[model samples]
Target: MQNLQEGERALTAAVAAAGRTRLWSHPELGLHAFVDAAGSVRLGTSDRNWAALVPLVEATATGHGRLWSGERFVETAIGDRLAYRGHETVEDGGRERTTIRLADSVTGLAADVVLETCRGAGFLRARVRLVNEGGTPLRLESVTTLTLGGIAGADDGLGGLTLHWADNDWLAECRWRRTAFRDQVVPLSRSVHGHEGRGCFERCSQGSWSTGRHLPMGALTDRDGRAWLWQIESSAGWRFETGEREGAAYVALFGPDDAHHQWHQTLAPGEEFHTVPAALVRTEAGGLDAAFGELTDYRRDIRREHPDHRTLPVIYNDYMNTLMGDPTTRKLLPLIEAAGAAGAEVFVIDAGWYDDDAQGWWDAVGAWEPARGRFPGGIQEVLDAIRGHGMTPGLWLEPEVVGVRSPLARTLPPEAFFRRGGIRVTEHGRHHLDLRHPAARAHLDSVVDRLAGEWGVGYLKLDYNINIGPGTENGPESPGSGLLGHHRAHLDWMASVLDRHPGLVLENCGSGGLRMDYAQLTVAQLQSTSDQQDLLRYPPIAAAAATAVTPEQAAVWAYPQPGHTLDEIAFTLAGALLGRVHLSGFLDRMNDDQFALVRSALRLYKDIRPEIAGARPFWPLGLPGWDDAWIAQGLRGRHSTFVTVWRRGPADGTSCELTLPHLRGARLQPSVLHPTASDSTAEWDATEAKLTVFLPRPDTAVLLRLR
Candidate 1:
């Protein structure tokens, strides 16, 4: 026993002699990580002290990581028991990537934490690779892709930290709300309890709809304006939590977990699993505006290259309040001409284009054939009409599902469809397609080839309307793992389609912003921001769309009816000018003046699109409220900054002030770029960096340009 104690002391001395603690810094991203001899990592921004940081890697396996008394994903035995391996850094195309390796001697679990950062960028992209080096299988319940600690206000402790998250729904997407961190994660006296609290403020995806409940993105800001923003890139399932740890705050981001997502994985010897990618952005000051700006840049850097991101073409879709999924040649010919005249570059024939049956087309929709009765001259005639008006032809398709009554549902193998208990899973009269199967992939490939290749379609709006519950049970894998596999395969299939048809623009729509995550947005060219029909209720969504997606990739609807006043028409049109324009409405029947107003908005958008493609989004009045009387959103570029303000209530004569601190001391000019004849006015105060704008009428909106 004495010899054993002496040997343990000698081993501890050897570890200390070998440098028990090491600090790793990524100056470009302002990230500092400290690793102790026990392989516990604490990550923080350079602005925080190393001593305040907590363990970075948190994991919970079947028989490990139960040391702490909490549902929180920290203090895992595997995390604390790991031994730090050497790290390697590599530079590729001006971006630097560093990999830190760690291994647990007890469980034989090895992890490679990979972080990638671009030069001069203020964000870090992170993912983890977990491998089983033991002779036996290891079951994993949860593992964090990225974890950060040591987050506290410069002056106060956790008292100054404010938590911000967005509540997402079908129509009410990106409804950002903020509260004091202490309000959600109440103080637990560690001095009395002698242990961390057992609860955390967590937001997680319920099922297939990643953003069905809340966005996979959030922020923490201090009173002094410093901000830390994070986003988990997963279309399958995700969870993010922030809680008090060791007198400070820590954030843990996970892809999927057993407790919340029914996702667990058993890794055999020599097997490995990779977590979904996540990103973090830290700003010294400026709060969410600055942090989100850096995140936008990072998003642009990581997404697949496509021309639609740069061109920012105006798209006219025959959905929303216009057609309501019922369309025909008689209804489309005039609209095509009118849309082309309104400067639309793409005209998409939305749902019901393939419905030939008297019954609705919702369930019987796998076959994407144009109805002969609706288009007696063939769908090609309308396609040619769109081309005649100098616009590219597009179509809407829901590729991930097959109608219960469709022939493809019977023809596709059972393995190709989502199955549970040896029976096919059906939802809303549709059977979900498991893209991991070759047959399912081939079917979608043939469909895309037929539309984009044979018919020469330039754009495709891939809509997913049904959430197919947990996932398929084809193999001996958890339902969560199955969902993750399908999500990855779906992304790969989209990328393959783009590789084959590089010019084809694909719009990602999941019942309107339900699947709004970076995993899908990084591949698809555009994301449908929402399907809200009421123009009045759309301002908040439009104002906060940038918080969920990049401005260039976010698609907002601008549906102006002919019965509305000029202000109403301009109000709807202005909401879409900052992002990709999805023009709808009865433009064919509108009076000349109303049509001209839409045309003017489109023309102005065309002029400013070059700057928008390179701009970073900022909210002057902070994130919009669901029922706020006033809302404001801005895009800042190199030479110009544009602001869009909407007044929805409080009658007339109401004005709002927007603070743009970045432009405080500049000699500037402010002009109403759209609806140039409206009664709305904008005045700039360089001394205070505030822009006071007034729209004399309610339900009115205006777009302003500052240079």
Candidate 2:
């Protein structure tokens, strides 16, 4: 079995061999497009397997080339460089030729397989083209699978894992049990559920599932309406049952079936089909959020070079109803000043700054104007105020939407709006902008430029409240084209906006958790977890924390109302230990005791900010369940650590014993600090085994520091 590094090398060699045949030069990252050696056509990288495919060709192929027997074939090569193409061809006499073409756009014909080493956790992409060279339309079925090289086992590093999906449910047919060579299998029962408007159907899980064990990730689907994407991190592992079922056609190593799954399309007389699969390895170095952030940086470096990239953290001021209507500048100015004093790196002035009449701000999204009534001195005054407070100011814009009453609706080109005739007009208080159109890009760019250059806005929160329809609205188009226009437009807009703003922070939001996917994460700096911030909703939030690599980049807001005590609020705030923190409560309304508590917690968070931001997170207390309490901790280096614990409902007599891993063999001192009590500290040696701590109910948390 080849290791990741060795696999990458092998793959690179194969691409080089193929490149010689087509005489094509390889393209650099971000700028290159995969092409076919036979016909010299362009092929795009798969969304899932980008890392694996890009590097191999860049290292081997160079120049231009193409390989396609007809329009219905997949052809990809290293942009203008080496070309590697594989496809099936049918002759007039009912004969078929399935071949892999490798040619250098510079040199010419090479070998078959481009075996490159798989560095870190990456993917291997091979373009499959099916052409009707014999003057007839062809019907074909194909699937691409990678055989991993590693010892199969359960304890070899895989266990306690769960798969995530935007919409779907898991089914357990049997408990996980070890098989041969440390391999394990967990049985999955078939289940049906709706996921974000799509029907999901999972076949029974009948394959071995492991965390970092033999298999890191896997997906399986027939050419039907069922598809799956499964991934598990090395830090968290789970067991499952796997075996042949009585009626199933094939056994999948992982994933449940969902109804909303869509299948790859069929190639007509002049059509083509493309497929891609990607895999990544996880580790105990940090939570998923941190890991993802690192990956994003790596991919960015591989693709394009950004000269002035810097990390910027932000806090929202108007989220707590602090800024509504035409409030006196005197009232709002101080809060912004206070937030800046509290070490808030960026200050955002949310909605209501725009009026429906002037600049048509509220009703007119397309017209970028500040309401004169709301901002008597114009947006420049607000910007100057934020700058004076020693903080960067950010503005929120829902550029994708437009209100019906806005003047732009009547003046703008009719094609700008998305509609389905009278039955479905793109009207929902605001209409979504057609990003695919050139005019839309130009308009958005103008607005973004004004905010960045004119107002000196350092950050932009781009929010979208709608989904795009397929290209079917454009007439009789292919299923792929239906969504392609929107996809292309989104990519183009993101690239353009980021290029224009350079170092500006772009936070993506879709009502909240709806857009928490890799595609969006690639372009935006942060994502909102969900709108539900009630203290009781911490369990699901914590669960989601593991799924995404950077929950710290998630927007988590906390506040204390009249009925809730400061201690209760602190307990709730602890749950945010797994991610970034956003506070929305009215600070001025709090009493001295409550204010003091906030100050104390803020101080502690500030002290351990580095650790909480960079270290691997430990959910000592499992996901928050109703009537259940738990603790979450994160440790950085050897001496710094932060802990957060919460007790929901009435206090129970139950005490939780937490066994700390990665801390054994170290000298440590632990202390408990309550809002009403003084801090108590104790010393212990963790050299021999895991350190155990006991917590009584009503929820209490302790911080551990190494001496």
Specify the highest-lDDT model's number. 1
The digit string of per-residue lDDT tens for model 2 on 129-171 reads: 2332323333222122111111111232213223322221121
lDDT of 1 by residue, 358-449 (tens): 77788898878889989999999999999999999999999999999999998989899988778899999999999999999999999999
Local lDDT at 291 for model 1: 92
Question: What TM-score, to 2 decimals, does candidate 2 have?
Answer: 0.64
- Write out the backbone clash pairs for model 1: 65-77
**lDDT values, one for every candidate:** 0.88, 0.42
| Global lDDT of model 2 | 0.42
Worst 10 residues of 1 by lDDT: 1-10
Candidate 1 segments whose C-alpha is farther than 4 A from its true place: 1-15, 18-20, 46-52, 651-653
- Alpha-carbon shift of residue 608 in model 1 (angstroms): 0.6
